[model samples]
Target: MVAITDKEFKQLTEYIKVNYGIHLKEEKLMLLTGRLQKVLQQEGFNNFTDYYHHILNDQTGQAVVTLVDKITTNHTFFMREADHFYFFRDRVLPFLANTVQDKDLRIWCAASSTGEEPYTLAMVIDEFFGKDKVFWDTKLLATDISSQVLDIAKKGIYSNEKIAPLPKHWKTNYFKKHDNENSVLIDKIRNEVIYRKFNLMDTTLPFKKKFYTIFCRNVMIYFDYKTKIELVNRLYHHMEYGGYLFIGHSESLTKEFTKFKYIMPAIYRKE
Candidate 1:
Protein backbone atom coordinates (compact mmCIF):
# COMPACT_ATOMS: atom_id res chain seq x y z
CA MET A 1 0.00 0.00 0.00
CA VAL A 2 1.31 3.47 -0.91
CA ALA A 3 0.86 5.55 2.23
CA ILE A 4 0.59 9.34 2.22
CA THR A 5 3.23 10.89 4.42
CA ASP A 6 2.13 13.68 6.76
CA LYS A 7 3.89 16.26 4.57
CA GLU A 8 2.35 14.77 1.41
CA PHE A 9 -1.10 14.83 3.01
CA LYS A 10 -0.70 18.50 3.98
CA GLN A 11 0.53 19.51 0.53
CA LEU A 12 -2.22 17.66 -1.35
CA THR A 13 -5.08 18.91 0.86
CA GLU A 14 -3.74 22.47 0.73
CA TYR A 15 -3.72 22.33 -3.07
CA ILE A 16 -7.30 21.00 -3.14
CA LYS A 17 -8.67 23.71 -0.79
CA VAL A 18 -6.82 26.53 -2.57
CA ASN A 19 -7.89 25.43 -6.03
CA TYR A 20 -11.28 23.76 -5.39
CA GLY A 21 -12.29 25.04 -1.91
CA ILE A 22 -12.47 21.50 -0.40
CA HIS A 23 -11.09 20.90 3.06
CA LEU A 24 -9.75 17.43 3.85
CA LYS A 25 -9.61 16.48 7.50
CA GLU A 26 -7.15 14.34 9.47
CA GLU A 27 -9.56 11.38 9.44
CA LYS A 28 -9.67 11.44 5.63
CA LEU A 29 -6.04 10.32 5.47
CA MET A 30 -6.98 6.67 5.17
CA LEU A 31 -9.68 7.36 2.64
CA LEU A 32 -7.41 9.62 0.59
CA THR A 33 -4.63 7.06 0.60
CA GLY A 34 -7.03 4.34 -0.54
CA ARG A 35 -8.40 6.43 -3.40
CA LEU A 36 -5.09 7.94 -4.54
CA GLN A 37 -3.04 4.75 -4.77
CA LYS A 38 -4.64 3.72 -8.07
CA VAL A 39 -4.31 7.28 -9.34
CA LEU A 40 -0.63 7.43 -8.38
CA GLN A 41 0.12 4.14 -10.12
CA GLN A 42 -1.73 5.27 -13.23
CA GLU A 43 0.28 8.49 -13.29
CA GLY A 44 3.52 6.44 -12.92
CA PHE A 45 4.41 8.33 -9.75
CA ASN A 46 6.27 6.20 -7.19
CA ASN A 47 5.37 8.21 -4.08
CA PHE A 48 2.82 10.75 -2.86
CA THR A 49 4.96 13.84 -3.41
CA ASP A 50 5.52 13.15 -7.10
CA TYR A 51 1.80 12.58 -7.62
CA TYR A 52 1.02 15.83 -5.77
CA HIS A 53 3.51 17.87 -7.83
CA HIS A 54 2.26 16.39 -11.09
CA ILE A 55 -1.39 17.00 -10.26
CA LEU A 56 -0.84 20.52 -8.88
CA ASN A 57 0.10 21.56 -12.41
CA ASP A 58 -2.74 19.56 -13.98
CA GLN A 59 -4.83 22.55 -15.06
CA THR A 60 -6.79 20.52 -17.61
CA GLY A 61 -8.87 19.49 -14.51
CA GLN A 62 -9.13 15.76 -15.25
CA ALA A 63 -6.84 14.72 -12.41
CA VAL A 64 -8.38 17.16 -9.99
CA VAL A 65 -11.88 15.99 -10.87
CA THR A 66 -10.90 12.42 -10.06
CA LEU A 67 -9.38 13.59 -6.81
CA VAL A 68 -12.60 15.34 -5.90
CA ASP A 69 -14.77 12.33 -6.81
CA LYS A 70 -12.81 10.06 -4.54
CA ILE A 71 -12.59 12.35 -1.52
CA THR A 72 -16.07 13.91 -1.36
CA THR A 73 -18.96 12.04 0.24
CA ASN A 74 -21.96 11.75 -2.12
CA HIS A 75 -24.23 9.42 -0.15
CA THR A 76 -27.92 10.37 -0.54
CA PHE A 77 -31.34 8.91 -1.34
CA PHE A 78 -34.70 9.74 -2.87
CA MET A 79 -36.91 11.30 -0.20
CA ARG A 80 -34.12 10.82 2.33
CA GLU A 81 -35.27 13.89 4.20
CA ALA A 82 -39.01 13.19 3.96
CA ASP A 83 -39.97 16.12 6.16
CA HIS A 84 -38.32 18.71 3.91
CA PHE A 85 -40.30 17.53 0.90
CA TYR A 86 -43.59 17.58 2.85
CA PHE A 87 -42.77 21.03 4.18
CA PHE A 88 -41.96 22.31 0.71
CA ARG A 89 -45.19 20.90 -0.65
CA ASP A 90 -47.38 22.26 2.14
CA ARG A 91 -45.59 25.55 2.94
CA VAL A 92 -43.00 26.74 0.43
CA LEU A 93 -44.72 25.61 -2.76
CA PRO A 94 -47.95 27.48 -2.00
CA PHE A 95 -46.02 30.56 -0.96
CA LEU A 96 -44.08 30.21 -4.21
CA ALA A 97 -47.23 29.73 -6.24
CA ASN A 98 -48.84 32.85 -4.77
CA THR A 99 -45.86 35.19 -4.90
CA VAL A 100 -43.88 34.18 -7.98
CA GLN A 101 -46.37 35.23 -10.66
CA ASP A 102 -44.16 33.85 -13.37
CA LYS A 103 -44.89 30.28 -14.37
CA ASP A 104 -41.19 29.89 -14.98
CA LEU A 105 -39.47 28.61 -11.82
CA ARG A 106 -35.76 27.91 -11.59
CA ILE A 107 -34.45 25.27 -9.20
CA TRP A 108 -30.77 24.51 -8.72
CA CYS A 109 -29.89 21.09 -7.42
CA ALA A 110 -26.42 22.34 -6.66
CA ALA A 111 -24.73 19.12 -5.57
CA SER A 112 -26.66 16.82 -7.86
CA SER A 113 -24.41 13.76 -7.84
CA THR A 114 -25.42 10.51 -9.59
CA GLY A 115 -28.80 12.18 -10.38
CA GLU A 116 -30.89 11.01 -7.42
CA GLU A 117 -31.38 14.35 -5.65
CA PRO A 118 -32.34 16.39 -8.71
CA TYR A 119 -34.48 13.61 -10.13
CA THR A 120 -36.21 13.42 -6.80
CA LEU A 121 -36.84 17.18 -6.94
CA ALA A 122 -38.22 16.91 -10.45
CA MET A 123 -40.54 14.11 -9.32
CA VAL A 124 -41.96 16.26 -6.53
CA ILE A 125 -42.50 19.17 -8.90
CA ASP A 126 -44.11 16.94 -11.49
CA GLU A 127 -46.39 15.48 -8.85
CA PHE A 128 -47.61 18.88 -7.68
CA PHE A 129 -48.22 20.70 -10.99
CA GLY A 130 -48.44 17.65 -13.32
CA LYS A 131 -46.44 17.21 -16.54
CA ASP A 132 -48.55 19.60 -18.61
CA LYS A 133 -47.96 22.54 -16.27
CA VAL A 134 -44.28 22.00 -15.44
CA PHE A 135 -42.96 20.41 -18.62
CA TRP A 136 -41.83 23.68 -20.17
CA ASP A 137 -41.08 26.65 -17.93
CA THR A 138 -39.87 25.26 -14.64
CA LYS A 139 -36.32 24.05 -15.26
CA LEU A 140 -34.37 21.97 -12.78
CA LEU A 141 -30.71 22.85 -13.26
CA ALA A 142 -28.64 20.00 -11.83
CA THR A 143 -24.90 20.48 -11.46
CA ASP A 144 -21.77 18.94 -9.96
CA ILE A 145 -18.00 19.13 -10.48
CA SER A 146 -17.68 15.49 -11.56
CA SER A 147 -18.11 14.95 -15.28
CA GLN A 148 -18.27 11.21 -14.64
CA VAL A 149 -21.33 11.56 -12.46
CA LEU A 150 -22.88 14.21 -14.71
CA ASP A 151 -22.85 11.69 -17.54
CA ILE A 152 -24.79 9.22 -15.40
CA ALA A 153 -27.19 11.94 -14.31
CA LYS A 154 -27.73 13.10 -17.89
CA LYS A 155 -28.41 9.58 -19.09
CA GLY A 156 -31.11 9.42 -16.39
CA ILE A 157 -30.69 5.66 -16.00
CA TYR A 158 -30.60 3.67 -12.79
CA SER A 159 -30.44 0.00 -11.91
CA ASN A 160 -33.72 -1.66 -10.92
CA GLU A 161 -32.10 -2.53 -7.64
CA LYS A 162 -31.06 1.06 -7.07
CA ILE A 163 -34.48 2.58 -7.71
CA ALA A 164 -36.46 -0.26 -6.07
CA PRO A 165 -37.44 1.68 -2.99
CA LEU A 166 -39.29 4.40 -4.99
CA PRO A 167 -43.07 4.11 -4.74
CA LYS A 168 -44.43 1.79 -7.44
CA HIS A 169 -46.76 4.37 -8.93
CA TRP A 170 -43.96 6.94 -9.03
CA LYS A 171 -41.68 4.47 -10.78
CA THR A 172 -44.40 3.92 -13.38
CA ASN A 173 -45.13 7.63 -13.71
CA TYR A 174 -41.59 9.04 -14.11
CA PHE A 175 -39.51 6.22 -15.56
CA LYS A 176 -39.37 3.82 -18.49
CA LYS A 177 -37.51 0.56 -18.93
CA HIS A 178 -33.95 0.68 -20.29
CA ASP A 179 -33.13 -2.19 -22.70
CA ASN A 180 -35.85 -4.03 -20.79
CA GLU A 181 -33.70 -3.77 -17.70
CA ASN A 182 -32.90 -0.67 -15.62
CA SER A 183 -35.12 2.39 -15.18
CA VAL A 184 -34.65 5.77 -16.81
CA LEU A 185 -36.73 8.93 -16.58
CA ILE A 186 -39.08 9.58 -19.50
CA ASP A 187 -37.93 12.11 -22.11
CA LYS A 188 -40.50 14.70 -20.98
CA ILE A 189 -39.20 14.86 -17.43
CA ARG A 190 -35.59 14.34 -18.49
CA ASN A 191 -35.74 17.22 -20.95
CA GLU A 192 -37.12 19.51 -18.23
CA VAL A 193 -33.87 19.07 -16.30
CA ILE A 194 -30.57 20.56 -17.44
CA TYR A 195 -27.47 18.77 -16.19
CA ARG A 196 -24.22 20.75 -16.27
CA LYS A 197 -20.75 20.64 -14.80
CA PHE A 198 -20.14 23.20 -12.08
CA ASN A 199 -17.35 23.81 -9.61
CA LEU A 200 -18.90 25.34 -6.48
CA MET A 201 -15.61 26.90 -5.44
CA ASP A 202 -15.77 29.43 -8.28
CA THR A 203 -16.59 32.94 -7.07
CA THR A 204 -18.98 33.69 -9.92
CA LEU A 205 -22.24 31.80 -10.47
CA PRO A 206 -22.51 31.16 -14.21
CA PHE A 207 -26.27 31.44 -14.63
CA LYS A 208 -27.87 34.68 -15.90
CA LYS A 209 -31.03 34.11 -13.79
CA LYS A 210 -30.98 33.74 -10.03
CA PHE A 211 -32.39 30.55 -8.51
CA TYR A 212 -35.66 30.41 -6.49
CA THR A 213 -34.45 27.49 -4.33
CA ILE A 214 -31.04 25.85 -4.13
CA PHE A 215 -30.52 22.34 -2.72
CA CYS A 216 -26.81 22.28 -1.92
CA ARG A 217 -27.19 19.53 0.62
CA ASN A 218 -24.30 17.43 2.00
CA VAL A 219 -21.63 19.11 -0.13
CA MET A 220 -20.46 21.73 2.35
CA ILE A 221 -19.43 19.33 5.12
CA TYR A 222 -16.13 18.85 3.24
CA PHE A 223 -15.34 22.55 3.51
CA ASP A 224 -13.39 24.03 6.41
CA TYR A 225 -14.65 27.10 8.28
CA LYS A 226 -13.22 29.67 5.87
CA THR A 227 -14.38 27.92 2.69
CA LYS A 228 -17.77 27.13 4.19
CA ILE A 229 -18.52 30.75 5.07
CA GLU A 230 -17.31 32.05 1.70
CA LEU A 231 -19.34 29.48 -0.27
CA VAL A 232 -22.48 30.03 1.83
CA ASN A 233 -22.30 33.79 1.37
CA ARG A 234 -21.83 33.41 -2.36
CA LEU A 235 -24.79 31.02 -2.57
CA TYR A 236 -26.83 33.56 -0.62
CA HIS A 237 -25.89 36.20 -3.19
CA HIS A 238 -27.00 33.96 -6.07
CA MET A 239 -30.40 33.27 -4.47
CA GLU A 240 -33.56 35.32 -4.95
CA TYR A 241 -34.65 37.62 -2.08
CA GLY A 242 -37.08 35.10 -0.67
CA GLY A 243 -35.20 32.05 -1.87
CA TYR A 244 -34.71 28.99 0.30
CA LEU A 245 -31.52 26.97 0.96
CA PHE A 246 -31.48 23.32 2.04
CA ILE A 247 -28.23 22.10 3.48
CA GLY A 248 -27.61 18.67 4.93
CA HIS A 249 -29.41 17.90 8.16
CA SER A 250 -25.91 18.00 9.62
CA GLU A 251 -25.09 21.49 8.26
CA SER A 252 -25.70 24.83 10.01
CA LEU A 253 -25.85 28.57 9.13
CA THR A 254 -25.94 30.00 12.68
CA LYS A 255 -22.16 30.26 12.56
CA GLU A 256 -22.35 32.83 9.75
CA PHE A 257 -23.76 36.35 9.45
CA THR A 258 -25.85 35.51 6.42
CA LYS A 259 -29.32 37.11 6.12
CA PHE A 260 -30.82 33.59 5.81
CA LYS A 261 -32.94 32.59 8.79
CA TYR A 262 -34.20 29.23 9.91
CA ILE A 263 -37.55 28.16 8.58
CA MET A 264 -38.02 24.46 9.42
CA PRO A 265 -35.28 22.20 10.74
CA ALA A 266 -32.38 22.22 8.21
CA ILE A 267 -34.30 24.62 5.95
CA TYR A 268 -33.39 28.31 5.70
CA ARG A 269 -35.11 31.14 3.87
CA LYS A 270 -33.37 34.24 2.55
CA GLU A 271 -34.22 37.54 4.16
Candidate 2:
Protein backbone atom coordinates (compact mmCIF):
# COMPACT_ATOMS: atom_id res chain seq x y z
CA MET A 1 0.00 0.00 0.00
CA VAL A 2 1.30 3.44 -0.87
CA ALA A 3 1.79 5.72 2.09
CA ILE A 4 0.39 9.24 2.26
CA THR A 5 3.21 11.75 2.06
CA ASP A 6 3.31 14.60 4.63
CA LYS A 7 2.09 17.20 2.13
CA GLU A 8 -0.67 14.92 0.84
CA PHE A 9 -1.78 14.22 4.40
CA LYS A 10 -1.96 17.96 5.18
CA GLN A 11 -3.94 18.64 2.02
CA LEU A 12 -6.48 15.91 2.64
CA THR A 13 -6.89 16.64 6.35
CA GLU A 14 -7.23 20.38 5.81
CA TYR A 15 -9.83 19.84 3.10
CA ILE A 16 -11.83 17.52 5.37
CA LYS A 17 -11.63 19.91 8.33
CA VAL A 18 -12.62 22.96 6.36
CA ASN A 19 -15.43 21.33 4.41
CA TYR A 20 -16.80 18.76 6.88
CA GLY A 21 -15.60 19.97 10.28
CA ILE A 22 -13.87 16.64 10.71
CA HIS A 23 -10.44 17.00 12.29
CA LEU A 24 -8.22 14.28 10.91
CA LYS A 25 -5.01 14.36 12.93
CA GLU A 26 -1.57 13.32 11.70
CA GLU A 27 -1.85 9.96 13.43
CA LYS A 28 -4.77 9.14 11.15
CA LEU A 29 -2.55 9.18 8.03
CA MET A 30 -2.14 5.41 8.02
CA LEU A 31 -5.88 4.94 8.53
CA LEU A 32 -6.67 7.35 5.70
CA THR A 33 -4.28 5.53 3.37
CA GLY A 34 -5.86 2.20 4.21
CA ARG A 35 -9.38 3.54 3.58
CA LEU A 36 -8.62 5.60 0.49
CA GLN A 37 -5.88 3.61 -1.25
CA LYS A 38 -8.32 1.25 -2.93
CA VAL A 39 -10.30 4.15 -4.37
CA LEU A 40 -7.09 5.73 -5.66
CA GLN A 41 -5.97 2.47 -7.24
CA GLN A 42 -9.38 1.78 -8.82
CA GLU A 43 -9.60 5.32 -10.22
CA GLY A 44 -6.10 4.90 -11.79
CA PHE A 45 -4.53 7.56 -9.61
CA ASN A 46 -0.74 7.15 -9.34
CA ASN A 47 -0.33 8.74 -5.93
CA PHE A 48 -2.02 10.70 -3.14
CA THR A 49 -1.25 14.03 -4.83
CA ASP A 50 -3.19 13.03 -7.93
CA TYR A 51 -6.11 11.87 -5.79
CA TYR A 52 -6.04 15.16 -3.89
CA HIS A 53 -6.18 17.15 -7.12
CA HIS A 54 -9.05 15.01 -8.38
CA ILE A 55 -10.96 15.68 -5.18
CA LEU A 56 -10.25 19.44 -5.40
CA ASN A 57 -11.08 19.78 -9.08
CA ASP A 58 -14.06 17.45 -9.40
CA GLN A 59 -16.95 19.70 -10.52
CA THR A 60 -19.86 17.39 -9.67
CA GLY A 61 -19.02 17.05 -5.91
CA GLN A 62 -19.77 13.33 -6.21
CA ALA A 63 -16.05 12.68 -5.69
CA VAL A 64 -16.19 14.39 -2.31
CA VAL A 65 -19.28 12.38 -1.36
CA THR A 66 -17.47 9.15 -2.22
CA LEU A 67 -14.43 10.30 -0.24
CA VAL A 68 -16.58 11.12 2.80
CA ASP A 69 -18.46 7.81 2.57
CA LYS A 70 -15.20 5.90 2.60
CA ILE A 71 -13.36 7.92 5.25
CA THR A 72 -16.01 8.91 7.79
CA THR A 73 -16.66 6.35 10.51
CA ASN A 74 -20.32 5.40 10.90
CA HIS A 75 -20.12 2.83 13.65
CA THR A 76 -23.41 2.87 15.52
CA PHE A 77 -26.00 0.32 16.65
CA PHE A 78 -29.38 -0.05 18.30
CA MET A 79 -29.56 1.49 21.74
CA ARG A 80 -25.86 2.40 21.62
CA GLU A 81 -26.54 5.06 24.25
CA ALA A 82 -29.56 3.88 26.21
CA ASP A 83 -29.87 6.64 28.77
CA HIS A 84 -30.75 9.34 26.30
CA PHE A 85 -33.70 7.27 25.09
CA TYR A 86 -34.89 6.81 28.63
CA PHE A 87 -34.64 10.52 29.37
CA PHE A 88 -36.41 11.37 26.16
CA ARG A 89 -39.28 9.01 26.88
CA ASP A 90 -39.65 9.86 30.55
CA ARG A 91 -38.97 13.58 30.50
CA VAL A 92 -38.67 15.25 27.10
CA LEU A 93 -41.68 13.64 25.41
CA PRO A 94 -43.93 14.30 28.36
CA PHE A 95 -42.95 17.97 28.48
CA LEU A 96 -43.56 18.34 24.76
CA ALA A 97 -46.82 16.43 25.07
CA ASN A 98 -48.12 18.89 27.63
CA THR A 99 -46.69 22.13 26.29
CA VAL A 100 -46.71 21.96 22.47
CA GLN A 101 -50.28 23.10 21.79
CA ASP A 102 -50.29 21.91 18.19
CA LYS A 103 -49.75 18.28 19.19
CA ASP A 104 -46.76 18.12 16.84
CA LEU A 105 -43.42 16.88 18.18
CA ARG A 106 -40.48 17.83 16.03
CA ILE A 107 -37.44 15.60 16.58
CA TRP A 108 -34.24 15.58 14.58
CA CYS A 109 -31.66 12.84 14.67
CA ALA A 110 -28.89 14.92 13.14
CA ALA A 111 -26.37 12.11 12.74
CA SER A 112 -28.57 9.11 12.23
CA SER A 113 -26.09 6.70 10.64
CA THR A 114 -27.75 3.35 9.97
CA GLY A 115 -31.29 3.96 11.31
CA GLU A 116 -30.94 2.54 14.82
CA GLU A 117 -31.01 5.77 16.83
CA PRO A 118 -33.90 7.35 14.98
CA TYR A 119 -35.83 4.08 14.81
CA THR A 120 -35.37 3.64 18.54
CA LEU A 121 -36.72 7.14 19.07
CA ALA A 122 -39.70 6.36 16.89
CA MET A 123 -40.40 3.17 18.83
CA VAL A 124 -40.24 5.03 22.12
CA ILE A 125 -42.60 7.68 20.86
CA ASP A 126 -44.96 5.06 19.50
CA GLU A 127 -45.04 3.35 22.87
CA PHE A 128 -45.39 6.64 24.71
CA PHE A 129 -48.44 7.83 22.82
CA GLY A 130 -49.92 4.38 22.15
CA LYS A 131 -53.63 4.87 21.38
CA ASP A 132 -53.26 8.63 21.48
CA LYS A 133 -50.56 8.67 18.78
CA VAL A 134 -53.17 9.33 16.09
CA PHE A 135 -53.80 12.79 17.46
CA TRP A 136 -50.15 13.86 17.37
CA ASP A 137 -47.52 14.26 14.70
CA THR A 138 -44.46 12.24 15.70
CA LYS A 139 -42.64 11.83 12.41
CA LEU A 140 -38.87 12.26 12.87
CA LEU A 141 -36.27 13.79 10.57
CA ALA A 142 -33.02 11.81 10.38
CA THR A 143 -30.02 13.16 8.48
CA ASP A 144 -26.48 12.07 7.75
CA ILE A 145 -23.79 13.33 5.37
CA SER A 146 -23.19 9.98 3.68
CA SER A 147 -25.71 8.79 1.14
CA GLN A 148 -24.29 5.29 1.60
CA VAL A 149 -25.47 5.20 5.19
CA LEU A 150 -28.67 7.01 4.35
CA ASP A 151 -29.48 4.30 1.83
CA ILE A 152 -28.95 1.64 4.46
CA ALA A 153 -31.07 3.67 6.90
CA LYS A 154 -33.84 4.04 4.33
CA LYS A 155 -33.92 0.29 3.72
CA GLY A 156 -34.64 -0.27 7.42
CA ILE A 157 -33.03 -3.68 7.49
CA TYR A 158 -30.39 -4.98 9.89
CA SER A 159 -28.60 -8.22 10.62
CA ASN A 160 -30.01 -10.29 13.44
CA GLU A 161 -26.91 -9.53 15.47
CA LYS A 162 -27.35 -5.81 14.86
CA ILE A 163 -30.92 -5.91 16.13
CA ALA A 164 -30.06 -8.16 19.08
CA PRO A 165 -29.43 -5.34 21.50
CA LEU A 166 -32.82 -3.77 20.89
CA PRO A 167 -35.47 -4.27 23.53
CA LYS A 168 -37.54 -7.42 23.10
CA HIS A 169 -40.79 -5.51 22.87
CA TRP A 170 -39.37 -3.17 20.27
CA LYS A 171 -38.06 -6.05 18.20
CA THR A 172 -41.42 -7.76 18.19
CA ASN A 173 -43.40 -4.65 17.51
CA TYR A 174 -41.23 -2.89 14.95
CA PHE A 175 -39.42 -5.62 13.01
CA LYS A 176 -40.14 -8.72 11.01
CA LYS A 177 -37.85 -11.57 9.95
CA HIS A 178 -36.91 -11.67 6.30
CA ASP A 179 -36.33 -14.99 4.52
CA ASN A 180 -32.61 -14.58 5.26
CA GLU A 181 -33.39 -14.10 8.98
CA ASN A 182 -32.20 -10.51 8.88
CA SER A 183 -34.60 -8.14 10.65
CA VAL A 184 -36.48 -5.63 8.56
CA LEU A 185 -38.18 -2.73 10.21
CA ILE A 186 -41.94 -2.77 9.61
CA ASP A 187 -43.16 -0.03 7.29
CA LYS A 188 -45.26 1.53 9.99
CA ILE A 189 -42.16 2.21 12.06
CA ARG A 190 -39.79 2.76 9.13
CA ASN A 191 -41.97 5.38 7.50
CA GLU A 192 -42.06 7.43 10.68
CA VAL A 193 -38.42 8.46 10.14
CA ILE A 194 -37.74 10.69 7.16
CA TYR A 195 -34.10 10.37 6.16
CA ARG A 196 -32.16 13.11 4.36
CA LYS A 197 -28.56 13.85 3.36
CA PHE A 198 -27.18 16.72 5.41
CA ASN A 199 -23.69 18.12 5.84
CA LEU A 200 -23.34 19.79 9.24
CA MET A 201 -20.77 22.32 8.04
CA ASP A 202 -23.34 24.08 5.85
CA THR A 203 -23.42 27.74 6.94
CA THR A 204 -27.16 27.88 7.39
CA LEU A 205 -29.81 25.34 8.42
CA PRO A 206 -32.74 25.62 5.98
CA PHE A 207 -35.47 23.90 7.98
CA LYS A 208 -38.75 25.78 8.22
CA LYS A 209 -39.68 24.32 11.60
CA LYS A 210 -37.51 24.31 14.72
CA PHE A 211 -37.09 20.90 16.35
CA TYR A 212 -38.09 20.11 19.89
CA THR A 213 -35.23 17.64 20.29
CA ILE A 214 -32.02 17.05 18.35
CA PHE A 215 -29.99 13.86 18.67
CA CYS A 216 -26.50 14.64 17.32
CA ARG A 217 -24.80 12.01 19.43
CA ASN A 218 -21.22 10.75 19.03
CA VAL A 219 -20.55 12.75 15.84
CA MET A 220 -18.73 15.77 17.32
CA ILE A 221 -15.73 13.70 18.47
CA TYR A 222 -14.42 14.04 14.91
CA PHE A 223 -14.67 17.85 14.94
CA ASP A 224 -12.23 20.38 16.39
CA TYR A 225 -13.25 22.70 19.24
CA LYS A 226 -14.19 25.68 17.11
CA THR A 227 -16.27 23.58 14.73
CA LYS A 228 -18.07 21.91 17.60
CA ILE A 229 -18.84 25.27 19.23
CA GLU A 230 -20.16 26.75 16.01
CA LEU A 231 -22.19 23.66 15.32
CA VAL A 232 -23.65 23.77 18.81
CA ASN A 233 -24.67 27.40 18.40
CA ARG A 234 -26.27 26.64 15.04
CA LEU A 235 -28.15 23.76 16.62
CA TYR A 236 -29.36 26.05 19.39
CA HIS A 237 -30.73 28.52 16.87
CA HIS A 238 -32.57 25.76 14.99
CA MET A 239 -34.21 24.36 18.09
CA GLU A 240 -37.39 25.54 19.76
CA TYR A 241 -37.19 27.38 23.07
CA GLY A 242 -36.82 24.71 25.80
CA GLY A 243 -35.75 22.17 23.22
CA TYR A 244 -33.33 19.41 24.25
CA LEU A 245 -30.04 18.34 22.68
CA PHE A 246 -28.42 14.96 23.21
CA ILE A 247 -24.71 14.50 22.58
CA GLY A 248 -22.49 11.50 23.09
CA HIS A 249 -22.01 10.43 26.68
CA SER A 250 -18.28 11.06 26.30
CA GLU A 251 -18.84 14.55 24.86
CA SER A 252 -19.41 17.78 26.73
CA LEU A 253 -20.07 21.39 25.83
CA THR A 254 -18.04 24.03 27.62
CA LYS A 255 -20.57 26.10 29.59
CA GLU A 256 -18.67 29.30 28.85
CA PHE A 257 -18.98 28.96 25.10
CA THR A 258 -22.51 27.57 24.83
CA LYS A 259 -25.88 29.16 25.55
CA PHE A 260 -27.46 25.78 26.47
CA LYS A 261 -28.00 24.89 30.10
CA TYR A 262 -26.30 21.67 30.99
CA ILE A 263 -29.15 19.41 31.99
CA MET A 264 -27.03 16.34 32.74
CA PRO A 265 -24.31 14.17 31.29
CA ALA A 266 -24.65 14.11 27.48
CA ILE A 267 -27.80 16.23 27.60
CA TYR A 268 -28.44 19.97 27.35
CA ARG A 269 -31.50 22.21 27.18
CA LYS A 270 -32.19 25.52 25.46
CA GLU A 271 -33.53 27.98 28.01
Q: Which candidate is the best by lDDT?
A: 2
For model 2, residues 146-171, the per-residue Cα lDDT tens digits are 99999999999899999898888888
lDDT of 2: 0.93
Candidate 2 TM-score to native: 0.98
Q: For every candidate structure, what is the RMSD over all alpha carbons to the true structure, in angstroms?
A: 1.8, 0.9
Displacement of the residue 231 alpha carbon in candidate 2, Å: 0.4
| Tens digit per residue, CA lDDT, model 1, 1-271 | 7877899999998888887778888898898899888888888888999887777788886877888777766676677777777777777767777678666678898899888888877777778776456333767899888777888788989888778878899899888888666888898778878999898999888889887899988887878888888888998888888888998888888845677888877899888
List per-prediction Cα lDDT, in the order shown.
0.82, 0.93
Q: How far off is residue 14 in model 2, in Å? A: 0.5
Residue pairs clashing, model 2: none
